[model samples]
Structures are given as structure tokens and as C-alpha cells.
Target: MTTPRPAAPSPTDALPGGLGRRFSWRGRQIAWTAFGDGPPLVFCHGTPWSSWLWAPYARALSAQFTVHLWDMPGYGASSMLPEHDVDLGVQGEAFAALLAHWGDGWGEAPHVVAHDYGGAVSLRAALLHDARYASLCLVDVVALRPWGSPFFRLVRDHAPVFGRLPPAVHRGALEAYVGTASHRGLRDDELEALVVPWLGDAGQAAFYRQIAQADERYTAELEPLLGDLDVPTRVLWGEQDTWIPADRAGRLSAALGHAEARLIPDAGHLIQLDAPVALATELRGWLAEVGAGRR
Candidate 1:
């Protein structure tokens, strides 16, 4: 039986490094935690992972920048989107709305840090609404191609069938996919932490529904738009990313025209988890290099 999910953390937490949580957007409860007291840097996590994935980096970067993190819809503490056909379009619109809200009242555009699916979401925001971003740090992002795990292909083809299977099949497939993509593998607590949020029927349905919305054409759109993007963009990659081949790093840089790529020697698909300090240092340096310091 599923126990009550833990109460989401409050906007103001007792943790060190400038922490706050429970930020709302349009009455939709979005679990947001921020740290530091400088120019804002918003972080967006990839699929199956929530904002909690970036907690370490948020803690480290809080010293130099006010780090903002949010659980995307259907993940972490945020409410799932009501629509069943949630795609990049819907997600992009929501993200655009967030940036517009931030620009109007919260503060000026913040430097965006994104990973994997977050990268795509961030790019969508930047391409359509460039005014809300100061700079970008995209890591393990999908771009310029249709590179994805074989498992993703399976999901794309079989979600309708597998999505209807008994709870055990659903649970097993989710666990296996998570295991295959995770480079260093997750500990028991870590696995439970990530898996617990998606255990119920609502959560499972949302997961499949969202997955169905990802269109490979989104990557193609980035290729043409990257050249026109004025915001100084940078790429970070795990040297040994299994899910997204390491070779794609070069492709992304070349396609972006003005972006630089950094390969973290021993990191994997989850760069923030594998090398928090190194990632933070690189980001801080980039922030400084690009004048992304507190405004």
C-alpha cells in the first residue's frame, strides 16, 4: 500500500546555503527552493528526476548566486498538469509563463541551468521567448539529432500497451529503465526517493502521458534556432554518458555555432550528481565570464 507522500519542504528551510521551498505559480503549487542572495539562476531537471536532483549544486552555487529550483509538473512536489496530452508545447508555455512572471515582478531574467529534458525545455523557452534568459548552461541535453535510449523507442512504440499492464509490469519496466541510464547506479534510498513520487495511479498515468508528448522534431528545431540565439550558451557533458552518446557533445557545439563544450572526464548522464563541485565551479566561472553575477 502507498503511504502518504511526505509533506513537501517549506519555502524556507533550515538547511545551509540559502534554502527556501514551496514557491507557487498561478495558484498551482510548485515546489521551489532557492539559495544564496545574488543574481538568480534557475535550474530545470530532466525526466524521471525532480528538482531534488540538483540540490547539491544549488547548495554550492548559493554562495555566488541565488539558485532557484522547481519540481516540474507531475514530478516532485508540483501538481501534475490536468491535460492528458501534455507535450513540449504545453510545458513550454508553462515555462514561458514562469519567465514572464519572473521578469514582470520577481526579478530580471536569470541564468538558466538545464539538464537532459530540462535542456530541451530551456531551449524552448530561449528560442520562443529570449527576453527571460541572461545566459544558459545546458548539460546532457538533446539537440540537433534524435539520439535517445533504445528504451525510449520502446516506450514511444509500446506505451499504450505497456501502460495498461498490471502494476508489477509498470513498476519493473520503470525500474529497469532507470537502472540502465543511471551510470553509477542509485542507492536504495536514492532509488526509493525518485520512485516513490510516481507510485500511485495518477502518477503512473501522468508519466506515460507526458512521455507520449515528447516529439523528436523538437531536437531539429534547436539546430536552426541555436544560430540565432544571442544569449551566450555553453554545453556541459559527462565524458561517459551512456544514454546520450558522448559524441553528440561535439554535434551540439557545432550546431549552436557560438557555444563551447566541456566534457567532464568521469561523469555520466547525471552530471550534477556525479560531479557537483566540479559542475558548480565550472558554472561559477562561466557566470563570472559571462557577467552573470548578481545584478
Candidate 2:
């Protein structure tokens, strides 16, 4: 794989800031966008998308809480993980590093909000290092059960071949990458921006490697950790999500101890993008309740 360009200067490197900064943990570099100014609330974006995915909701969330949206290791503005350690455990450790950096001023766990692959990565962190999260909000996340879609099956069979392909072809692949159970379908701009970075040979290779290994190296050990999680948790879903199957909500709801499962009627796998208004409303309410109890 071609070496990744050094992460563009930290968000702090330029621009008078309200929502951008960078942090270096261990030897890894992470880029983040922060909004609001209260106790920390971190958001983790999943595959192909970046922290920018949370912008629509941040408008409202920034009004009441400190919202920190991060570009997971390779997807957004964050630097690529060194070629040596890119598995799930390593990704979770990266998250833990960011959490520690974000929690420097706070005395307890910061509320963690995550979606899709982000949910998997965060759950791994919370499980391996207990007390790292005060509360969690999982949106359209993958649970322990294995229910492979035709797409997933394709990956299982063709990852090696897929990994070697030229990045130029990724432009055509974005449509499939962003497809979800939701009926709205991905808009042109959304699909383009999500896939732009991966259009290069190195980017495409890096992406395929991560996706192919996520389940085998990370999720298999991740599921068992859920039953032991004692943190306040909420699992929300897009009722229309077809990618991972909406039915899995009940299974996740039950497995997460006290986690409540909510369905956003017209939304799909990319719930926040499809129904940011509804997603934010639910998130705000959950945050309110958690805040109230703390008071």
C-alpha cells in the first residue's frame, strides 16, 4: 500500500476554530470536529463517511452539550493507522486514546454516541476497558448475530481480488457501498464525498483491508462483551434499514440489558442522514435524561 500522506495539519493548525482540532495519541494521529461546550459527547462515524456525517445533528446538539465528532482512523480527516496495526483491537485502542484526550478535563466517562462500524469499535473499547463510557447511543449498529447480506457474502469470497483492484474503480462502487435498507437511496453528492478519498490505489486497498478484517479480527470477540456491559445504553434504528435487516433491533435490544430500541420510520441504514431531525430529537431526549439523573 502506498504510504498515506501525513495527516493534513491538525484542525488547530489553521482557521479560527469552533469545530476543528487534532490530537496525537501514542504514535497515531486523530482529527476531530467539536461543537457546543458542556460535558463531552463523542460521535463515531462509520465506513466511507466521516465526522461530517454528524453535522446536521450537531446544529441542535451543540446548543446543549459538548459534541465531539471524530473521523475514525482511515475514513475522514484522521491519519491512517500505521500499516502494522489496523485490526479491531487496535482501532478500539485508538478510540480509547481519543477518549482519554477528550476526558482530560472531565472526571468520569464521556457519553459515547456511535453508528455502524463505529458502534462495533466503541463497544470493543468499552468492553476491554470498563468505565471508559458513561453512556452509549448506538444507531443502526451491527450486533452479535451473523446475518450476511449478498454484499457481505461477496466480500467473503472476493476480498483478496477486490483489494488488488485500482482505486479509480471505486467511483462506480460507491453506490453499492452506501446502499442501506432505507428506501430513500443515497443522493449523488453524499455518495461522491463518501467515496472521494478511496478513489486512489492506496485508499482503496486500505479500505478493503479494514472492512474484510473487521468481523473476523474484532467482532467475534466483541459480541460476548455486550452481555456484561452495565452502562446506560440506547440502541436506535432506521425502521427502513435493509442493509443489516431491521429485525435485528429486537435481538440487540434484548442483548444490551437495559438498552431501549427505537425505530425511525422513514429512515434507512444511514439513519442520521436520512432522518437527522428525528435522530437528534431522540438523542437530545436521551442526553436530557442522562443529564437529569446525574444532577
- State TM-scores per candidate: 0.86, 0.85
lDDT of 1 by residue, 41-159 (tens): 88888787777677777777787788787777666667776553456655565677766655564556789988888887888777865546888888988765776688787777777
Report model 1's TM-score to 2 decimal places: 0.86
The 10 consecutive residues of candidate 1 with the worst lDDT sum are 10-19
Q: Top model by TM-score, which number?
A: 1
Model 1: residue 255 alpha-carbon error in angstroms: 1.2
lDDT of each: 0.72, 0.70
Which window of 10 residues has the lowest lDDT sum in candidate 2?
Answer: 7-16
Q: How accurate is candidate 2 locally (lDDT)?
A: 0.70
Relative to the unseen true structure, what is the C-alpha lDDT of residue 250 in candidate 1, on a scale of 0 to 100?
Answer: 83
Q: How many steric overlaps does candidate 1 have? A: 4
Alpha-carbon runs more than 4 Å astray in model 2: 1-20, 180-182, 292-295
